[model samples]
Target: MSKPRVIYWFRTDLRLHDSPALKVALDLEPECLYPIWTWDPHYVYNARVGPNRWQYLLDCQNDLSSSISKLNPRSKLFLMREGPTTLLPKLFNSWKITHLVYEKDTDAYARQRDIEIAKLAHEAGVEVVTRVGRTLWDSDRLVEKNGGKATMTQKQTIAAGDKIGNIPRPIPAPKFLPDPGELNLDFESQKPDIDADLNAPHRSSSDKSYAKIAGPNGDFAIPTMEELGLTPATTPHRGGETIALKTLAAIIKDEKYTATFEKPNTAPTAFEPQATTLLSPHLHFGSLSCREFYWRVQDVVDNYKGKASQPPTSLTGQLLFREMYFAAHAKLGFSFEQTYGNPECKFIPWHLPSKIDPKSGLKTREYIVDSAQADEWLNRWKYGRTGFPWIDAVMRQLRQEGWIHHLARHAVACFLTRGGCYIDWERGLEVFEEWLIDHEPACNVGNWQWLSCTAFFTQFFRCYSPIAFPQKWDREGKFVRRYVPELVHYPAKYIYEPWKAPIADQKKAGCLVKGDGSEFEDGQLKLYPKPMFDFNERKDLCMKGMKKAYSVGLRGNDPKVIDGSWSALFSDGDHPLGRVEQKTRVDVDEKVGRDRKRRGQGTLDNVITKKE
Candidate 1:
């Protein structure tokens, strides 16, 4: 038989170490190996990725390319610029590819995309080998073990995991790699149109990454941030397997920190050296294997002489939460990302409702600005000038650094959705989608639902006080002061509520707490806006709205929700209301469906985010 001419596709898994798919590829003992990254246009043009994420992705790809070269002098990560759907078939014939392999991705888009690629491979008589290394166990198998239901809770995930036998151990990377076949792209490149680019807002120049099939150099070189027309990434955190392993080694070396670590006990305000393990971005990019992280942390817990923290709160618990989200997304598919059309997500009448695509029946990235006040509030939250220093600090930190502590995430997410602005959680999720370097769709969507009291959680009345929450974490207001420098010199008593400080104190602080926070007053260089609204009043209003939503007991898959007439059920007395007029892309289309069950079992059933 002809020696296997294998093409190893690089997707979720970027690192050489602990890569199950890479090991399977090497086990083939191919005469030739081609490690390639297809720069799919789906994310480049359609997704809401910001500069920070783009830069981080490039960092990982370049780092992997360098590592691959180090393993073999003649080979590197050959980054081909084209959609996998169009490019793979051409490459197969051009390179005489006999086998294809990649790490399994269970994301809705990825599943569909892979199916198409697998079909192409089959038609060309190419054998395909796939391995699941992104999570503890195959997310699909976890869901199947749970009777094909979405693992909505950590308990469900744990039960499903227990049934799935043991998680796979890490495999060692090959000491040497076979040389790649002759590089040839004799086919025409099919470049996607950039008309409907969702990330256009982040770009300051025209994007030219798609100008050539092999990244302008014709050597399959890694694309730079400049090639994508994005502004320079401001995040201080970097990405690479080298960095990921080093960081993990450091954490494991400190046995006390690893064995006794609890998520809740970590201070959200801690920065410079962040309070918790900042390995999430590495995990997301597949530079760090989740299974590797899980086993490493478990090993420490087992060997520890002193008391070790337990799951749902322990380090192992954190890994399980990630697995839970992965399983939930695997089962629910595309609808899992939004409240609409998702059976698992509870329905709530939130401001800035998402614009559902009539043809696809899925919510688009765009939103209907039904309320001007809510729209303005979302802007304030995004730009980090919400008048609440604690919330503003975290928001600013996220934008500038592309990350914030977990509790810090809880605060900002709650404020954006049900807790404060009464805006849609989708809005906050979109911002995170753009800004988070470690943004995993499953975790972001799941956590948003939890924080918004929509599905995974239901503690409507228990809200984080913007003033109290951060004060509890940082009494000196260092975090708030660091992010919100306008109030850096303000007295600690009024650090969170800078507007409450006396006028002289504000002046002495070298900042004025006045105006609407967008424009400067009297040409003042540093002016902080007053609180957007009375926090006490907004909190009470949000609570009342949540109660009404709870009483109605509707879900995303409900007929009323499909038609969106669910708004009528939420009376004006339930919460404050307003109207905003702007040039929106799509107006609200009232399409009514035959009402199914008007009530849901979720009504007063379980409160997952019940202030634990």
Candidate 2:
């Protein structure tokens, strides 16, 4: 009998280490092994990605290709410049492949695409095998353990995880890989349409990524940022399995930091070397194995002499939160990312809501400009000109670096949603999806929901203060000065509230706080925008609106929310949540103020400190 000729599809799992699927493929002892990656147009044209993330993906692909060459000189990651749906069948027939193996992806799009591919594989007479290694445990199995329901809370995730037993240990990378058979691409390439590209705004040049079936040199090399028509990446972070392993090794060597580390204690304002381990992008790219990360931290905690931090906060606890989101996403499918059809998410009647397609009954990925003022606020917020120094700094950092500390994320997200703008959380979700290098569909949607109090969390009254929240972590305002350089000369006392400084004080500081942050005077004093709105008043308004929403208690799946009848629940007015009676607003504000003062919580610090 002819030995199995295998094609190892490299998708999310970009590394060669601790890969269960790779181990499975190697265990077959195939006659020839072909490692390949098809440059899918779904991500290129359809998804919102910036230069930083695009660069990071290229870095991972190049690193993986180099590593494969090291193992076997005759083989490397073959770059097929076409969608997998059209490319894979041709490769199977051309190479006479009999087996296909890859890591299983439970993401909504991946699940659907895999189903189509699996059907094609069966028709083509190719055997398919897969394994789960992206998260601590198989997300589908976790849902099964939870009685076929989404893991909504840390407690629920923990219970489901306990039922699923211990997470499996990571397998070792293969020392040797079989050389591939003759390379042949006898079929024509099918390129995707680019007229309505979702990422057109991000490109400064024409995209040439699909110019050829093979690469420019016909060597099956990774595409470059220039090929993708992306601007230069501004982030300092780089990606690779080698770098990931080294970073993990260094963190594990700290022992105490790894064993006793807690998420809540990490300083979001610290820069240069960020407070938490900046390994998220690596995990997202599969440059680092989640299991390897978990076991390494777990071993440190197991043998530690000092008291180790526990879950929902500890390093292991962080992994569990990731598992929870993955399980939830797996259970809910595409609905998990949006509020329209998501049963778990609450209907908020937020401003600038998603424009629903009447035919499909899904978001058109375009938002209705219901309020011009709110639209302007969102644009300013996206470009880091919100005038709230703390929020602006974090937003600027995210735009330039493609990553931010978790608390910083909470501050910005809260400011954009229930806390301030009253805009839909989906808008913020789209921005993060575009800019964040570490963006995971499950984690991003989950965190946005938690921050917006739409799902997974419900403390809508607890809002992060644009002024006081960052002050707790960065009293010196060093983080603000680093990212928002226009305020470099402002005194620390007025750094977080530069607009509050007297005009003389602002001029003396070599910057003027005026205009809407559009003025750029070269060789002259700089200009920064003033606070967009009164924070206290907006907070009170948002709280009242949240209270009204909670009282209504309608979810995304509600008939009223699906139709247009939900708006009747709120009184007609200019306010996004409709006019809360003046009397009720004042009453709730006073009561909340008294409660907060009694609890010694002057800011959102106390409320969000314990959250993951």
Candidate 3:
């Protein structure tokens, strides 16, 4: 029998290290192995990606390609500039491929795409092999272990993990890769339509990445940011397996830090050196294996003589949280990303709701501007002109660096959703999707839900105080000064609330706290916007809205929610009623409270305690 001619598909697992799928393909002892990556247009045109993420992806691809060349000079990651749906079959036929292999991705889109590809491969008489390496355990297995339900809590994830057996140790990288067969790509490329590209706003020049199937040089080179028409990336963070492994080595060298690390204790305001391990982007890009990182940290904890911090806060606990979100997304599929059809997500009659597709019953990736004020607030929030210094600083950091401290993310997310503006969480989610280098769909969506008190967390009453929250970490407002340079000279007392400074103090500071942060002159003193709204009043309003939403207790899958009749359930126009009309309201509130208590819902005290 002819030795299996394999095509090793590189998707989430960009690195050669600890890749289970790669190991399986090597185990087959293939005569010819073709490592390939199809540049899917779904991500290029449909996904909300910015230049920073594009740069990061290219870095990973280039590094992987170079690494592959080191193992086998005749083979590298073949860059097929077309959708996999159209490209793979042609390659299979031309190369006479006998086997297909890849790391399993449980992401909604990946799952659907993989199913179609598997069917096509079957038709072409190509066997498909896959293994889970992205997360600690297979997310689908986690859901299965959790009684076929989404792992909503850390406790549930832990329980599911326990039943799923210990997470397997990472496999070793292959020392020798098989040489690929003849390279033949004479087929025509089917380029996607760019007329309504979702990322058009991000591109400064015309996209030429798709001009040729084999790239500019016909050597299957990695596409550059210039080729994609993306503006220059502002982020300093770079991606590659080399950088990832090096960073991990440095982190592990500090055994004490690695062993006793706690997420809650990390200082969000510390910028020169971020508090937590900045390995998230690496994990997202699959430059670093989640299992590799987990085992390294776990070994440290196991060997530590001192008492180590434990889960829901510890380094290991953070990984569990990641697994939990993955399991949730795996169980819910596409519904996990949005509120409209997600049974797990709570429905809030927030301003600027998503525009749902009647045919698909899903969000159209567009939102209705229900309130002009809210729309302006969202735009200001996105551009780092929110008037709240802490919020503005965080937003600016996220925009420029494509990363922010976790607590900083919480503060800004809270201010945008339930805690302040009461705008839709989906709007804020889109911004994060566009900017964050470490933006994992499962984690981002899950974190946004938790912050907005929509799902995962139900502590709507416990909101992060934009002013007080940052003050706890940086009393001197040094972080603010670094990101929001206009407030650099302001006193620590008024830094978080710049508008509260006395006129003389503002003048002495040389930055006027006036206007709406839209004007600036090169020779003039800086001008910062005033606070957008009274924080205390907004807080109260948000609290009332959340409480009303909870009392109504309509989930995303509710008939009323699906049919757009949920608005009639609320007393105020677009606002949830603080008081309902009948005794039914009292019963609903009582039942909801009981359910919350039963679920062991956390309170503001729990968050404060965790921080302390």
Candidate 4:
């Protein structure tokens, strides 16, 4: 028999280091090997990727191509344009491909896409090989070990992981590569219907990414931001295997930090050199392997004499969190993204909820703008005009840069969902998907649920004080100053609550905290919006709503929730409980007295008593 003719498909894994899938492809010792990346239209048009992620992807592809060229001058990642489902079979037959090898992608859409491609490969009589390398253990296997249930918590993830064998060590990249066969793609291209484009909002110019079967230049070149008709990316985070390996080397060198690293203790305000290893984006693009990160950190803990942090909060614990989300998400396919039809997710009637896809019964990119107030608040939150400086600052940082600290994520997510705005977590999840350079579907969706108290976490009463939480990490408001520069000159006393500053003090700061968040300016003050709503009132309202929902105890998949009858069980204003009215200070005092009688302690309403 002739030697194997292989096509090494590059998808999630974009790096040369510690790639088990790449190692297996190399071990085949093929006579000819083609390292290729199909520029799938699904991502280009269907996914809600923004300019920052697109730029990062291009950077990774270019870097990987250059690295491959260095190993073997004749071999590099051959780029192709068109849907992978259509492109792969044609290439298989045309190039006389025998084996098609790639890393396993357990993402819901990816699994479906892979199944379609595998069936096509079988029809063409080409052997398709895949390996699980995205997560430490296969997400599917983890789910199976957990009795076919979602790993909802860190403890559950650890329990399920124990059944799976110890994670395999990293595989070294090949020193050399076999040259690719004849590169001639002379076939009719099934150009994606641009009318169905989901990322049309990002495109100011016409998208030319899928203009040709082999990209615009017709040499299978990586497309640029310009080619995709995207605005210039504002993010400082760059992606490449070369950069990722060096980062891991530095982190591993700091054995003390590596051994004792705790996620909770990490300062959310810290920057310049970020608090945590900003390797999440690297991990997302598979520029670095999860197994490689896990073991190196484990080696540090094993040898260190000092007491080290353990799972659920340790540096290794973060990996387990990722795995937990992956397994949980894999367990419930598309429904994992939204509360609807997800048994694990508790049904909450949030304002500005996600629009559902009728055919597939999944959430769409669009959301139902049911409440104008919720819509305006969401718009304000996204633009860093949320009145509260800490929340505003984090949102600004996220918008300007593609990354933010994890706790900062919690603050914004909590503020958006259960704590402040009473908006849907899915809204925030979609925004993260568009902006975060390191956004992983499972982690993003799972985290949103956790923060919203919709699933994983049941602490509806626990809310991050946008003011107090940031103050804990940054008492002087240095982080707020950096991102929300307008509030820079405001005193630390009033930085978190600039609207509360005396009018005379606001003048000294060269700004007045005014406006209703919907408008930009007031007179000559360059007015920042007033607090969107009474934070305490909103918090109290949400707490009451959450408790009521918990009492009902209906899951998203419940017949009542799916049939819309769930709405009848609760009221819709600010809280499921009726609203309180106090026309005067006397009335307020009386209400406070009645409140003391009703409960032992007053709600968060007393935290900041006055309205903005």
Tens-digit lDDT track of model 4 for 215-319: 777888888888889888999899988898899999999998999998999998988988999999999999889988999999999999989998878999999
Across residues 111-176, which tens digit of lDDT does each residue of candidate 3 receive? Answer: 999999999999999999999899998998899999999999999999999998998987788899
TM-scores of the candidates in the order shown: 0.94, 0.93, 0.93, 0.92
Best by TM-score: 1
TM-score of candidate 2 against the unseen true structure: 0.93
Model 1 regions lying over 4 Å from their true place: 520-525, 578-587, 590-612
Q: How well is each residue in 1-612 modelled by candidate 1, as lDDT tens digits?
A: 778999999987889999989999999999999999998888888777889989899999989999999999899999988889889999999999999999999688888899999999999999999999899999999999999999998999999999999887788777999999999778899987666777766788998868898887788899888888999999999998889999999999999999999999999999989989999999999999888888888898899999999989998899899999999999999999998899988888888777788788788655665665776788778877788889989999999999999999999999888889888899889889889999998999999999999888888787999988888889999998898887888899999888888988888888888877765544554798888999988888888888888899999999888865676676557765642222222336421111112222111111111211
Better of 2 and 4 by TM-score: 2
Instruction: Please report, as a residue range, the 10-residue window in candidate 1 with the lowest summed lDDT.
Output: 603-612
Name the regions of candidate 3 deviating beyond 4 angstroms. Answer: 573-612
Local distance difference test values of all predictions, in order? 0.85, 0.86, 0.87, 0.84
Candidate 2's residue-wise lDDT over 78-115, tens digit each?
98889988888888899999999999986888888998
Query: What's the residue-level lDDT of 500 in candidate 1?
Result: 85
Where in model 4 is the C-alpha error above 4 Å? 517-524, 572-612
